[model samples]
Target: MNALQLSGLITAVATAGIVVIGLPLAWLLARRSFPGDVVFETLILLPLVLPPSVVGYYLLIALGDAGPLTSAGVHLLFTWQGAALASTVVGLPLMVKSAKAAIASVDPALENAARVCGSGEWEVFSRITLPLAQRGIAAGTVLGAARAFGEFGATLMVAGSIPGRTQTMPLAIYDAVQAGRYGDAHSLVLLTSVLAFFSLLAVARLEQAGATTPAHGAPAGGV
Candidate 1:
């Protein structure tokens, strides 16, 4: 596949990975305060503060030939899957942080009411918490997908720039620039910029909706 198609696929996989991992973790952080909470959260969010190249180097070591996954006979080195993994790692912090804030904003009393009505934990979450917090979670998801779409340094280190395989848009742009293909580089950059702009705009609109919509009030039909 070409760079655009490859990026879309990687972003989809990365988004799914983050949602599976991040949602439960975000709920735990927002609902419970355990020992070492700060440490655990900081570690989860470290990629946000760390340099992308540094993050990529760490992934390279972990996914390389002699890595633990190799010991388990599950090789991902220099593959498109490796690029998606890198994107997932880097995008997780945004997902968790945004989701946590949204979950925490939900009133505990509302949850208690659901339990009083004989709702199970899963029912309460699905019927009450999720609906209330959907906007912020959506915003986080958009931001995470955006980050995954434009990922470069980490994906380069772990997956390498193999054309038609793992060469995502950012990597393709880098190669174009390096090969003195300014036209290709310019077009790719413009495309990436447009995607990023829309992603942020979506997030902003979600945030505005969340702010204006009352947290304590139920939706029109009620859950």
Candidate 2:
């Protein structure tokens, strides 16, 4: 596939998985504090702070041919799935952090009220907490999707920059530059930039929309 098609597919696939895993993880962090919470949160946020190369190196070891997963015969090197997995790792923290803040801002009293009104734990969360925090969660999801689109270093290390299968937008740009195809590189850069710019704009808009909500009040219909 060309860069445009490959990028879209990679972003869509990785983002879908990230949201599925991220939302509930975010909720867990927001609503409860378990043993080792800080430690787990720290691990999640490490990719944000650590050098991309460092993260890539670890992933390479974990998933490479000589890696433990390979020992179990689960090889992912030089594959689109590996690329998506790498992107998912980097994007997951943004989703979790953003969604956690959003969910935490929801009115605790509203949740209590829901419980008092015979809503089960799951029902209270599904009907009350999730809806109330959805704006922020949506924004976070966009941000995470954007992060996946920009995956390069770690993805390159783990997935390799194969032209059709593993070459995501950022990897394509890198390849263009390395091959001295300046025009192609420029085009790819512009394409990725435009996409990223709009995604970030959506994130900002979502955050702004979420800001209009009252921290202490329930939504209009019911708690």
Best by TM-score: 1
Best by lDDT: 1
Model 1 root-mean-square deviation? 1.8
At residue 123, candidate 2 shows an lDDT of 100
Over 67-125, each residue of candidate 1 has an lDDT whose tens digit, in order, gives 89988998888899999999999999999999999999999999999999999999999
lDDT, candidates in the order shown: 0.93, 0.86
**Against the true structure, what is each candidate's TM-score?**
0.96, 0.92
Which consecutive 10 residues in model 2 have the weakest lDDT in total? Answer: 214-223
Candidate 2 regions exceeding 4 Å error are 66-68, 216-223
Clash counts per candidate, in order, are: 0, 0
Once superposed on the true structure, which residue ranges of model 1 sit more than 4 Å away at CA? 218-223
Q: For model 2, how does the per-residue alpha-carbon lDDT over 57-117 read when each residue is reduced to its tens digit? A: 9998899768889999888877888888888888988999999998998888999999999
| Colliding pairs, model 2 | none
Model 1 / residue 150 / CA error / Å: 1.2
Error of 2 at 203 (Å): 1.1
